[model samples]
Target chain A: MIRMNKFIKLAIATCIIFSHSSNLYARDKLDIKGFLTIAGYHSSNDNLGFQPHLSSSDVGYKGDDEYLTLSKVGLQLNYQLSTQFELVGQIVAQKEVVVDNSDRIKIATLNYSPTSSLLFRIGRFAPRTYLLSDSRLIGYSNNEVIPNHDFYAQLPLSYVNGADLTYNFGLSDGVGTASIFTGRTEVNINATDGNTLNSKFKNLLGFNLEYQTNNWLYRFGYTQSQLANSWEQVDTAIQFLTLVSQDYPSPLVSWTEGKEFVEAYRVKDKWFRYKTLAVQYDNSIWRVRAEIGDLAADSSNIPKNKNAYVSFSRTFDQFTPFLTLSAIKTSSPRTFSKPDEGLVQFLSAQSNQNLAFGLQQVFQFAETSAYNQKSISLGVRYDFALRQDIKLQFERKHVEAIGSNLWVVKDFSKIKDEYVSLIMFSYDRVF
Target chain B: MNIRILIGLICFVFSSVASAEILVIVNKNNPISSMSKQEIIYIYTGRLMAFSNGEQAQPIDLYDGSQEKATFYKITTGKRLSQINSYWAKLSFTGRLKPPLALETQQAAVEYVVNNANAIAYIDEKYLTDDVKVVFRLDS
Candidate 1:
């Protein structure tokens, strides 16, 4: 089970205090707002657990960790320094299963707008890679109790220390916006040894284009970055293979060629590209949203994957019921050599089977770790009062064998294709 | 006969309250005479911050969940108050934009707009005064 940090406890207390008080900080030059979500989730299976995002570690909403799966609180401060320049800072304490300073401070930026159509911002800000990337933490702002895990959990990058420029114009009786950003980022993920794996991204560049009308919004976005750090596990395996290649006694099979294969599949220092297209339609009665995205990399360790989801919600006065279907699949699945392969056979004949097995397992460890699942969820949102809402959702997910990477499992050997049911409830409020 | 008369009087009161027309108002010196429905949407939603004449505009709203606020969004954008709040939440949290400045009551909204030349707001037609001019109207 994951331990709750002291910061999260303090955040909950602050939220409760803020909720009971009026907007005492509202002023002409400064405004303060806070949001809170008290949530819990339960999973059907005990063998596997659920995480909200890919970067989250192995322990999640199962066993004794159910209560901490989704509860969170956040506060934002906006100070208008001048008519043309403003400063904004927001802090959130949630899901700090692995506490990192960067993740807690979601946005800290200085904004400048010379004209109504052009704007600039610099500091730590979220990259708008998806429709909801920037506002993912505000549970009260979203339509679903939980976003599509298959789609949102694929990429762990949330905020980037960056600067961006945005230009808005009128087009087709709608408002069109074009934005470009450049920054560097870090993503902390679960390591195979139950530790944290830090992935550093450098020279990141991205752009987003959007057109929004009264009832419809269309978006297209793209981003590319280079991995700045090596995958330690894979790198160690490659080094071991290189040593074996130089020491092999027999020339019957070229161990050097086997070493080359591992070298070619390494993900370190590789370039990654991602693209997304999304659309949303809302008439205050029916809300429909759909999005498709793909992440591509040249290395085998980071396989190319595609994810998509469509959601529909209809409002009935104070109640809104929603249905969503989401899915993800690896387009280029990673594969590893078996003992029967030529390299393994040669190594076995020389009585170095342990080395061969170790190499095989190391290569396969990351290969088998890919997200491939289909999920459908039905939920209802009840606005019990202004600025307060409660939601309950039921989701069924079908996970493919060897594709339970998004889930934390007790035993990798026991992994198989199975259906998992999940129930989630959350109370969200903003003040 | 007395019960029927009481019921008729209650119906009249409720219908009049429901049928009141809403008028979008701005400072009389804003230089803009009238606004299109789309422009009003753009302003209230934080999409457009300037008038068609290139003058900066500030939009104001009645406090959250107030009857006048709900009726204004319903008539203009066909959106419930919750939806509008959700939309504003997305923008404000991003630090990209903020919703219109909220005033406690219809009278407060009128005073806010009247005191600021760039300000815009909406209120019931019965509250119309010389300090502010009607730029758009929504009939119930």
Candidate 2:
């Protein structure tokens, strides 16, 4: 009797999942779906501070943890408010940030589709950097490196906390549903200089353009953030001191890049603009990808260096082998950069471009020719999937060079360009 | 030529034709040319959406997890149950498309398909009827 009851319960649950309700017959409406993946993996290269936090390779210096973790479980809600309007929201529970909590609100935003090719979205959302922005940390179906980077996600400007506009041009027929974007994002952050630097995240405007066709897709975005001016920074320091003496805590939530708060709170003000460019192409058997980006204090004063990488993937039925040769001409200001270039500077540096070379494999129980899911991946990708929606993948990489802000901190143990890794695994059925 | 060898060859041809029995199929008076075996496979597998006359065709299958369902999978798609499930699972998970609607039994499904001008249903050659046209035949 007990066995029969358990079987019945299992059947009911499966039925509920397979026959879930969704919107139909409406141009603008809501469509919801979800994914769940769980897998086990181990690796030799403990990512430590050299890698993103999403991969099994990111085992840090000293800690006791599990050999396997629940990779990711989350739900996504997409609503078509109108023919030209949509709202997409996603929530995930990752092992790092939402470790103790299962109820994590990862993304919530509204998108307006003016045409089959144009879109405008606003709110907190995925920055859409790297390869797996749309695929996320689905571990079971991707190369080991993709989920690792996307899930162990560095603190990147990929997602801005404001508004974005995107445009796509291509046939809506053959390649399924694919789109690209050329949009701008508005954000506010604390500058390294004492002044707020226009109170707009170092006062930088994000410009991005993207495209996806039958076999290839690409995106390039630029943002300008004003660094602190030495003189104005001094003045702001004096004002902040006065405010403190008059009994007020600091009102600024985010601050300037490369400058730390001292007794007098002095800082420098300069403009740093970051440009991110990425491209990927795929055929039936072979695939290739490349990304390049930079953070400049201006066109001429590009003190904060950036880097890029290119990798190739080959698929053999259920198993895929990947080999990547990546290089960074300049230092990774973000991954190898410091935390307090003020809030704006820190974010500007990390998560954009840092370079390294690693090899990994993915195991998909079923063929995953189309997309990555939490259940479609294994190894580092699986772990990344666990934290798919709400995650904080970071490492404190220490760079030791003369006349450099990162050098001044001198936490030599975890220094070098930060290396991040992640993984996700899953199984699902939709009807 | 030996007389016995010639007789054997004639018997082989006769048996081949005997096994290739013609079956009748019915749909509510839709004008379509005869379908090849490959074309029927495409229709049932959801690959080719239109009929020979450029009309949108809807092919129906029995509800999965039944005897008729297994038999159809073996003959129509030449795939095992697991392969079909995985195929549908991959498509559905990616949010691109869904499997066709299922019915409870072959008889009920056949009745519905015969009544709908755009519908298609499969049956064994032994059950040939005057109501429908023979668009395709199974080889194995």
Q: Who wins the TM-score comparison?
A: 1
**DockQ-derived CAPRI band for the predicted complex in model 1:** medium
Q: What DockQ does every candidate get?
A: 0.63, 0.08
lDDT of each: 0.80, 0.42
**What ranges in model 1 sit over 4 Å off?**
A1-16, A20-24, A97-99, A191-195, A243-250, A255-260, A334-353, B2-7
lDDT of 2 by residue, A285-329 (tens): 466877766654432113345555566666444334555444323
Per-residue alpha-carbon lDDT of candidate 1 for residues A1-431, written as tens digits (9 for 90 to 100): 54567645765677677765434367778999878887777777766667777676435534554655577787889899998999999987666544367578888999999998788999988888888888887888987876689899877777889899998877778988999999998888764235566788998999999999879999999999988988677777776566555534444445545554566667778899999999999888999999999999866677578999999999999999999999998875644443235555665567555676777676676567677899999999998777778999999999987677777777667778989888888888788
Chain A TM-scores, one per candidate? 0.90, 0.52
